[model samples]
Target: MSDTTNHQRIIALEAENAALKARIASLEARLQLNSAPPQSLTHTTPTATPELSAEEYLRYGRQLIMPQIGLPGQLRLKNTRVLIIGIGGLGCPAASYLSSAGVGTLGLLDHDLVELSNLHRQILHTLAYIGRPKVLSAIDRLRAANPNVTYIPHITALDKENALEIIQNYDLVLDCTDHPRVRYLVSDAAVIAGKTVVSASALKTEGQLVVVNKPTSSEEGGRGPCYRCYWPRPPPTESVVSCGEGGVLGPVVGVMGVLQALEAVKIISSGALEGQRAPASANEAAAGSPGTEGPSKPEPASMLFFSSYSPTPFKTLRMKGRRADCISCGTPSDPALKITASTIPDYDNFCGPGPDAVLLDPKDRRTVMEVGEMIGRENVVVVDTRDETQFGITSVGGSRNVPFVLWQRGGKVPEEFWRAVEEEGNSADPQEEGEKGKGTKGKEVVILCRRGNDSQEAAKMVMEDPRARDWKVTDVVGGIGEWARKVGGVVEY
Candidate 1:
């Protein structure tokens, strides 16, 4: 097909997909209200049913009653070994539910501490338990939730030092860390270890989940597709933010985390929802095989992605197999997946923190507006550095109108404009020279102007000193115009 024709086709298909999602949302809401499974599969257990201990029995009572997850399925859950890497927001819910559901043995890895702010939706930590190691706290909380389960906690971040060793021991691996770098690294490690991986992500109010499991050819035994099949590389530096600094609706994560848990359970179980089809809802044939176990529960190497957005809705997309040119996973790296032992790759360097970090300044009044809402509680200050003409649109709600340039004629800055700005904040505190850069190096400053050029340079200039680099330095992503369309804050007219 011609390129234009293909492009048109893609657009049409995406629209169709969007429509289908809307319909799915409607159908799902109805399904919950009706308490229906659409189509329930019946699996008969053998005469000699395996005896589950008291804890296992109580924990899995609900799942076992379902014909699809009867005695055999419960056994499957008991025998399954699922490893959850990084127990942050996404990991917390996935791991919690997995443990509560009796996932037998759960292996967790994370090298961080819990802060009070994490309680907003992290769901794993409480204010009373703040300032404790995350891995340690997670294990304790998980164990208490379901004493029948076994908990294995690795108090270290996954890297070249332990990725292989850690991932190889589990039947499935769940990627819940918020770091894209770690996500990619874990994907490669799972592919190499010949294990099934279910990856999920939640940012702001949006979330994505993917299932990867490549099939072998007729001759050479093959592993499934890795995460690289879709996302090729991380976005440029300065294009990322954290939930700690970027406000997120706590329950938005609640929904995504629950979904992640469901996927993890489904990945390990050999029942209806795990890999099997969800049955025909409206005479629509299932996406995969008849009784086709979805990618969630695959033969060996498998992957699944599911994402949702609040103020919007929930959507699920499943992709199968590995890409040939996946920079991290493919024919060129099969031997890497065949590691005789578990290992962690050098994640920091692989993820990039090199000197050439691209610093983007998406500064604009609109940018300030979008970010103001993001850090609403912090009372972050926005500095307007636009010229007069552009200042007409600047929103002063979250900003202080400190135009860095006062032009006299022909776009030329007035005399001592820089000196005035340098000495302007002094009125607040003349004795404290260091305090002059209140929002610049210490408190919090988001430089904004028209088109993001002047503000970008201004922010960079303020942070030129090594001491100021420790201060939060960020350029609004996508410039002000883009921010205006996404999140509406306030614009000074």
Candidate 2:
């Protein structure tokens, strides 16, 4: 009886072991199936249109080798859509590589038409393409590089009306706009869409790129902070010269744009890995291996600046929300400082008491904000030569617009534009005349522009006048835009 019972027990144990082996085999097979690119994503399905063909498979064959971008990774790239909001400087290069890398769908947007000047850094617009839309130029260049991708060109400038809808369809956004106002808009839109934003900027000699997304917005396993999380409000605009005006080295923008592309690819690849149902291959896990992982890192979600000059690596700021005493973004949330892009106070409001004025560009050479302050006297006459529209756009402070364009073409007119300049000179007291007061004729004329272009022209026009020939005409080479930034010039929409 004991022998029979033992025999039965042995048989039962053997059956149990066999059952466990079968289960393990089934799981392994399922894992392989899970790792494959979805049929719908890889091949065009009637329900889910695949964008690639046999030709594309051969084209991207090399990229498919690395585990991260293997067959599965390539499919993620094919399904992803990226919106590049600026096609100049940084945007040019960013769009180029993303297209070269075969991003499935690409959106090109820019309001400006290409100029011969853009050719220095913007490789997309050839001499033949000059005077053409930047968006169209970028699209043509991108398509010429890779016909496998789909291109959408937008000639309209990016504004609130289309910011959300246009940005929403994209899995990622590239903010390559030149203006500070536009940058702020891009950051804000990224927050609203909860999409990955690979923002980059380049000036004279610097470039910067960052991965901005929140920690709970889907896509990647964990949502990361958006650009706004870093700079809740646009930081005080800086007094800087444009590359077009200041003169940038040809390759600087290219470097920055390439970096932007690198970040975008990383964002897409990261999202694919997180969304996958199965474990990635050993090598696949190491791509885009950033040192830090989550929100615990300081400067949670914010804007980052990069310089082209050596020794200046990366500067990122995570703007805090609704600070009690903060200005701009912080104060508005406070309800006390409701400053916005559209509604700033007048230039002559009670900003600082005691009848004081800030001089922006005292010298005519290049950037002269510091010179203006050094020689500028108290309660003195200030002459800003920028046009009226630019004056309003930059939120010009303590200055009147005697438009250089008008003065350049006015042919001696007596309009409100000229009256303001003459009155500013006549109102100042004579005793403090040497540095502060201007001889209605010899007074230091402060000329400015968005970049100092019109201002320089204005100064030249003033010098051309026989009556003001000997008069001192100072060109704030960096202009009011720089002035507003250096002297804390606030911007209204």
Off by over 4 Å in 1: 1-51, 214-223, 271-312, 318-321, 332-345, 354-458, 461-493
- In candidate 2 the C-alpha lDDT for residue 331 amounts to 30
lDDT of 1 by residue, 170-189 (tens): 77788887777777777777
lDDT of 1: 0.58
lDDT of 1 at 114: 77
Clashes counted in candidate 2 amount to 26
Tens-digit lDDT string for candidate 2 (106-135): 888877877876887888888876655677
Cα-based lDDT for every prediction: 0.58, 0.58
RMSD of 2: 21.5
The TM-score between candidate 2 and the true structure equals 0.55
Off by over 4 Å in 2: 1-52, 214-222, 235-240, 272-307, 311-493
Candidate 2, residue 362: lDDT? 38
